[model samples]
Target: MAYAMLEKFEKYWGDYSTLLAIVIVLDPRYMMVLVRLAFSKLSIPVEVEASIKEIYDTLVKMYKF
Candidate 1:
């Protein structure tokens, strides 16, 4: 049972880890500090970085309007 749980954790960790990190980074108190920390910790790709930048730009634009 423990082995099975560990296997499941590994599988989901790939999907959920980034999402969880993003949630933490989105916190107003931490913001870019958390984002930099997450990107440094995780093996984030260039494409993912570009996507994140685009999303941040869109949110900023929305706030301006």
Candidate 2:
């Protein structure tokens, strides 16, 4: 019973792990470098890629006067 509960907890955590990581790594000092490094470590999961790409695109548009 304990093992089953732990497994479910892990599954739930894994689902949002990348989003949590991105929120942490998003800082002016590190900028995109740490974000890229984190994604590389995660082997570039598709959902993470989409999230990062959205942020990148938004930044590009913002800077493109």
In TM-score terms, candidate 1 sits at: 0.42
> Where is the poorest 10-residue window by lDDT in model 1?
13-22
Give the best candidate by TM-score: 1
Report the C-alpha lDDT of model 2 over 1-65, residue by residue, as the tens digit.
99999788767654444445445556667776777666555545786687678667766665695
Off by over 4 Å in 1: 1-28
Each prediction's total of clashing residue pairs, residues at least 3 apart in sequence or on different chains, is 0, 0
Alpha-carbon shift of residue 11 in model 2 (angstroms):
14
Q: What C-alpha lDDT do the candidate models reach, one value each?
A: 0.61, 0.63
Query: For model 1, what is the C-alpha lDDT against the true structure?
Result: 0.61
Q: What is the lDDT of residue 40 in candidate 1?
A: 46
Clashing pairs in model 2, backbone N/Cα/C closer than 3 A: none
Which model scores highest in lDDT? 2
* lDDT (10s digit) by residue, model 1, range 1-65: 99999788668643434445455657888876766555545436784576457557755765799
Measured against the true structure, the TM-scores of the candidates, in listed sequence, are 0.42, 0.42
